[model samples]
Target: MKNQAYRMALLYDFYGDMLTDRQKEFYDLYYNEDLSLAEIAENYGITRQGVRDVIVRAEAVLTELEDKTGIIRRFHKMQEQFAQIADALDGICQLNEDRYQDDALEGLCAQIRSVLSDLKQE
Candidate 1:
């Protein structure tokens, strides 16, 4: 359940600008602010059912955008590839330390690690 919410938030982050102003507002209030339908409706001077309708519309928009673009899917794939690359680099670094003790190889590994760290941060 928690993971599903996180995924929705990530999708929103990617394609939220595509939503209408009211859709964005209602979606943010419901998901980010943890507001109930009644509370959001009260604040917006609408019925709870109206608020639910807006939120549902917003979700459909977000999911549709993700389906068309698949940017989120590509991002997760890249993250997994990066982790594999980092693990391989760690093995190479350890081998250098134990067997080769080569300064040049150590420096190169450090550079690769730095680049990986920067990419992961983004």
Candidate 2:
């Protein structure tokens, strides 16, 4: 709705498999081809309001799926956490060369991997 590329991509990936055929057609034209609602309506032989309704409904479906299946959301959170851990590990490698920190990093990486696996499971 707000036209952020990353958010749009997440919504598309999460609900891409769940859309109806007509919804998919409208979505592809609007999202993938960057078509305006008026253009989509004209190409699909529908009114602009009809195109708007289709897109709104599709977005609702995607939001509902994301709410129900938090794999995508959790995966995003995990990615951020992983990035932080990687940065910390790099700093540790440079600043603290010791067995204790190495063990801690190993444990942290294991936990991160477990979180990634949980997200992947869904």
Q: Clashing residue pairs in candidate 1, if any?
A: none
State, as a TM-score between 0 and 1, how close model 1 is to the true structure: 0.94
Model 1 segments beyond 4 Å from truth?
none
Model 2 lDDT-worst window of ten: 92-101
Candidate 1, residue 80: CA error in Å? Answer: 0.9
Instruction: State the lDDT of candidate 1 residue by residue for 19-102, as single tens digits.
Output: 899999999999999999999999989999999998899899889988998999999999999999999999999999999999
Score candidate 2 by TM-score against the native.
0.69
Give per-model TM-scores: 0.94, 0.69
Residue ranges of candidate 2 with Cα displaced over 4 Å:
1-5, 96-122
Query: For residue 5, what is the lDDT in candidate 2?
Result: 55
Highest TM-score scorer:
1
